[model samples]
Target: MRWLCILFLAVLASGCTAAPGSNQTQGISQDKSQQGAGQATCAGYTFASAEREISVLAGPGNAIGNEHYQRLAQALDCLAKTVDAAKISSVRQQLDRLNPDVKSVSFSAVQREIEALYNAGNTIGPEHYAKLDSQLASLGQAGYDISALRQQLETVRPLAEKTATADNPAALKDLAAINKLPECNGQMLSDPPADLGDVQEISPLGNIGVPGHTLPTPHLYFHISAGRATTNTVPLLAPGNVTITSVTSSFDELGKIDEYSIGFALCKDVYGYFNHVKGLSAGLQQALDTVPCADFTDNPGNRCAKDLFYPVNAGTEIGRVGHLQGNF
Candidate 1:
């Protein structure tokens, strides 16, 4: 509570974004040859420079009141709302006060100031608090003290029920149990099966360097192969070329341990070229578009059964030319 109040007060006082000006474009004329480039350059310079030039219009001696001055005024709207989450989950809650809202803010420096409020105050407005809760909830029930969490929620619920930032407790618990498994850290949680392939569990204490859990939030997406899986058997991919880029799930690293591992490989990294991605007779391409990865058991490989596999519903074909965007 103390930290939250401190962070919120800091945001209220900081002189941050540009003053509220017409977002509507101003007229600009240029030679046909330089038109596009000129506009881009102008937009960059004017937008960037005009920001600090604007005002916060503090009500008190040094305090600013304008929303435009603080990060909350300039955060980018999340356009990824429609992007297929598939194996991944996201919370719409407020972020740590130290973090930045890179999604909406043009200036990374400004955005960071906004993120400082991540877990700061849960009582300000429900929108911010709700997003924070939803994110933590997705961490799964492995190490969370549900009762304690609920107690905190009870306090928050009454004041901000109208603005939910967290997900339903029952939903979070169900997801955790579905993927529950013992690991070095504790229980490894799973992503409920998705239209795109879902992970059974992120292996704990995989190798010397690997951590006990895998979280998609930090972009560490991985999955362990359920059993023997391949393009032919799993119908997840057609055969062109296969190579693991990064593995998020782990069990053992030194010797071959096929039971728990998740590896990532972009289509562009696999096959040397792009096409309709007819490789997986199934919707694996579509799944790849969502997560584009498989569970890794060890450095050698992991098990993936046909049923456990989830292909991307829409994705691009891989090729030497690099990412050619399309959906199969």
Candidate 2:
């Protein structure tokens, strides 16, 4: 479930009704509040301690499709290149593969070899000093491509991204091509409904204004986006042919309030990740637990016939997104 945020700041109205007989009996709350009104009643959203209205900005989560997947993957590659990413992945693999199987091979000896190789990632090292400085610098950005073609099967032989010599630079070119391959879109995770064989179990989770609301499907999307920065993850809502019904977007008060009515859903048997799944936080786990799921196939609960339930973790709790209890 996602948040349908509506900001109410400036135009909020206040009313002063008659107080009780005794002024002292009717305690005046000097506290000020900005209530949302002049439209559909505020859709359900908990208000924190009062101060001023906080801006709520959120959008549907999940990759739109192959197009979005490719774009996001390219963006990640762009970030990696900025950090000399291939060299970084290669050097780490080398250090990780430092085998101590050779008898009498001390950690210091392996450490020195690893360090020497790592230094080359930043500059032409003592071991590989024959190349011209400018040429060596030009070589690294593409030096990690290994195969003549993209999409080399790792099972055949690990697709290495480092070349042994400047004379041998296939690794560098191969790496560049591989990263650009359509199949290699580096989306955190992308599984389209088109990929499903049979999708069933669809239910509405009620309305948030005209456009914003939640739906339950047998297979829902699972994703997470969090850090110090405000993150948005709407894995459950896949992007496809959306049926628009109504929408509201205008500036009320000093903040912007936008709403939409989109009607579209996926085939159910909801697709999602468990708490133990990677890229989840403890708070996220708790949020997932609140969305109760039942085996409609064997035992359907007394929710409106349309409710789509999900499996809780081993602890027997329901699943949720971003840790909001129940479906939004």
Candidate 3:
């Protein structure tokens, strides 16, 4: 299944400066001074501290959590205001490598690795099982919650014992099927959700150096600015006839405002989501009221209604931007 995302936030302009090519120590001092001056330009910015936290988390054996990832995203947003474009690109590359959730490394790869390890001997002792369990744990920490996969793997002992051959063909085949799962892979949208005229800017799906977005953002960011000012007066329309499957409400610490992310299924095995929404349409609000909310684990004070069947027609306004300089 395919997914979509929309992040609503004001874009920050980048700044650059050249250091002197004289004495090495003096050049370092000048660079530090320049960086401090640049930081001063953005009030209440935490790019420096956030960068340091990311560095620590990226260190060997450090567990990277959702909070750390959020801080990294926020830091990158702040960094855009003071760092050069090239610097941002470099940081993105570094983050892409550090992030275990990068698309190039699929969650199926973990399953395949475990399958291969089991097939090698058609057995798993305590040590081998522990190692395999750690791998699954690491994948969970990376944000893909595959509790079902874990549960299946837990039956490895019995599955292995029933097999006569060294290669557990049936088990391996089952693992391979995960790659074809709708959530793992799906078709892209045939058309844009909104008309070009409706959106001020449309960011392609990929790495986005912005707040609330990870290194490799999976969703598009639509900017609906009023002239040069970032305002939330524009209406957010549905791309296709879809069922609103979920809605997440979170506190955006950076914006100091509450935001909503809506997830919908365009069709069977095709899904999309939008983030940073300030307000929900009346229909959505009614649906949201009907469902009991559960706490979102990624961030504190976040609530989510994960199961819903609210259907919306194509071109329907499901939400609106409701604040000045607020992210949708």
Clashes of each: 54, 29, 8
Tens digit per residue, CA lDDT, model 3, 239-283 = 766666656575544445655766666555566566657678888
Can you write out model 2's per-residue Cα lDDT over 189-233, one digit (the tens) per residue?
233421122222222223122111122221232223222122222
The best candidate in terms of lDDT: 3
Question: Comparing 1 and 2 by lDDT, which wins?
Answer: 1
Comparison by lDDT, 2 against 3, better one: 3
What 10-residue stretch in candidate 1 is worst by lDDT?
Answer: 319-328
Model 1 agreement with the true structure over 161-181: per-residue lDDT tens digits? 421224544223222322332
Q: What does candidate 2 score in Cα RMSD to the true structure?
A: 34.2
Q: What's the lDDT for all of these models? A: 0.27, 0.24, 0.54
Weakest lDDT window of 10 consecutive positions for candidate 2 = 49-58
* Number of the candidate with higher TM-score, 2 or 3: 3
Q: In model 1, which runs have C-alpha deviations exceeding 4 angstroms? A: 1-33, 40-125, 137-151, 159-328
Stronger candidate by lDDT (1 vs 3) = 3
